[model samples]
Target: MILNGIITGLIMGGILSLPVLGVAVIYGITGIPNFAIGVIGVFGGFLTWYFLSFNMGIAILVGVVFCFAIGYIIQRILLTPISERGGDSTLFFIVTVSLGFVFEGLMRAIFPRPSISLALPRIGTINIAGVTVEGFKIFALLFALGTLVIIRLLEEHTEIGKSWQATSQNLKLAKLIGIKTNRVFSIASGIGCALACVGAIFWGSLYNLNLMTGWDLGFLGFIIAVVGGIGNIWGGIISALIMGMVMSFSGYLLGGMWQSVILYFIVILVLIVAPKGILGSERSL
Candidate 1:
């Protein structure tokens, strides 16, 4: 039983890390702590649900597009001004929080605040080395891995990624070098939002969707990002894996409800010790 629980923990940890990875990448590029990312994700999942009620494949496609649109619009309309005005980072944070609340309110107005699991055919669990795992969960983990690989490739191989790297290193320098830094930031924001939506839909299919689900888990992603060290992929993945294990064990030893509270303490500890994150470095973009 103990071994089984640990295996389960590893699986769940990997699954939860998907969104954190996306959140970390977005923050790395834009320096915007998007509190509304989770909201966007959950909403994407809801969009998937609404559409999948008819066709599964179309639902997934729509969820991806929907998330991308939301992220793109928000970046263009809201954050662009603040970035241009050299506004306070605190102001951006406030705006993001407000945006999250607004999304929650809108969701409440349109749908109930209860868990609404999408109706999809459940794949049978796979027994691996005495441990049983759900096929969908495996698919989710693969999807997350694929997304990470593709993003990494884009960052490494493409001209757009070069611009992103330039912007990430130094916004001013990037602009000076003709990278259209603002547009880069905008595009990165859109990409992050879209990625968050993908994570949302994947998780929503595994569980259910609610307005608050995104925001609630958004904080979790934030914690993982912090632990992983901001803007560091390796750190984020490491921290996310550790977080999953910690939460899983906490749930086993304590209670599921207390897992998050404990996780926060762990994050606080990591921050106090290495303020720049465990694997974070001050590298010029």
Candidate 2:
């Protein structure tokens, strides 16, 4: 039973890390707290589900690319302009939440379904010691970890990634040095939303997706990021793992009602102790 709980916690944490990474990356770079990313991601997840009958690969690609395009366009036309005009974090938060509602309405109107589930293929199962687990769940975990590694490598080796670091560190100085700050922000936003979409895909596959799931995920992701230290990738991952354990054990020992109660209680405690987050932000916003 203990081992089962541990395994469950790890898998849940790994999957949840996807949206946590998304929030971290976006806030880390653009310094914009986009509360809408989860909704946008769910919108893309529904798109993937809609096209699943045709081809899995194509459907996934369509969903991800569509989200990237949406993020790019929104940042380019709306968010960036607002930022340039001296909009603060609070303002961006309000705007992003409004954007989330628009996407949510569009999703309901177009998809015409209040709930959905992705019919992903079963990839067999694996046994760890005496425990058996699904292969797809492992894949989701590894994928999320691999994405972190790739992002780290990108920041270290690539010129574009260097620009991202520079822009993230000091936006005004990056502009002074001839970096396209607006473009950087847009790309970061796009990637963040894309990551969230991928997380949504995995989550919808593992469980059921409903109209409110996006808000749940979006808000959950943000809170996790905050607890882990907003804008800190490593911190976000750590916080997610801790939260996952809390969730698993809470459900195991307590019940569904206590799951969120304990989770939020821990978050509040963490905030009280470390206002910035567990590891603190890489670059304070």
Candidate 3:
């Protein structure tokens, strides 16, 4: 039972951590708390569902590409302009909150208010060290791990990755060196949104999904990012595991609904203790 609990935590945490990873990347670069990410998750999930209703593979491709485009546009049109004024965090927060409501309403208009589950084929079970692991959970973990690897490689290897790293360290300095800060921001935001999309598709396949589903997930992501330290993607993954474990254990004791309240409380406590987060190197705060 103890081994099962640990394995369950590993599986669940891996699957649920993408949004948090996205938040980490975005916050690390833009230094803005993009509250709209939650909406992006739901939007991506629904879009996937809509497309999959026609064809499966195409749905995944379309969902990823569409979310990336949307994220890019938001960064370019809304976030970039506001952020130039230097106090854009406040404005961005307000805008994202408003956008979340708009997304919720739009989703309600487009799809029924009733929950919809993506009917994916069950893969049954896998024998892992004599422990029976749910195939769906294993698949989700593998998907997330693949995304993480791709992201890590992108950040470390390619020219775009170099530019991103340079820009992240010092935006003004990067611009002075001709790194195209605006484009980098757009790319980072796109990647973040894409990550959310991947996360949503996996999550939606496993459970019932709706417009407001991303609400608590978004908060959970933000908390994981904050606790792990923004701007550090690796830290976000670690923090995600811790946060997931906490929530999972709490749910075992209290109830699922209270898990959210517990997360918020943890976030508040973390903020009071280490305002810059656990592994943050930036002096943004």
lDDT of each: 0.76, 0.91, 0.77
lDDT of 1 by residue, 44-86 (tens): 7777887776899899889778777787788878887887788
Among these predicted structures, which one has the highest TM-score? 2
For candidate 3, the lDDT comes to: 0.77
Candidate 3's residue-wise lDDT over 1-285, tens digit each? 556766777776776688887787787777777877777877878877887778888888887888788788889998888889775667888987787778778788887544777777789999988899889888888777777788789868988877887887888899999988998888778877788777777778877677777776677677777787876777777777777677777777687999878877887897789886777736121
| Model 2 Cα shift for residue 18 (angstroms) | 0.8
Best by lDDT: 2
TM-score of 2: 0.98
Segments in model 3 whose C-alpha atoms lie over 4 Å from true places: 281-285
In model 2, the clashing pairs are: none
- My TM-score estimates for the predictions, one after another, are 0.93, 0.98, 0.92
| lDDT (Cα, tens digit) per residue for candidate 2, span 1-285 | 788888888888888898889889889998889999999999999999999999999999999999899988999999989988999988998999999999999999999688999999989999999999999998998998999999999999998999999999998899999999899899988998998899999999999788788898899999999999999999999898889888999989998889999999999999999999999977531
Which candidate model has the greater lDDT, 2 or 3? 2
Q: Score candidate 3 by TM-score against the native.
A: 0.92
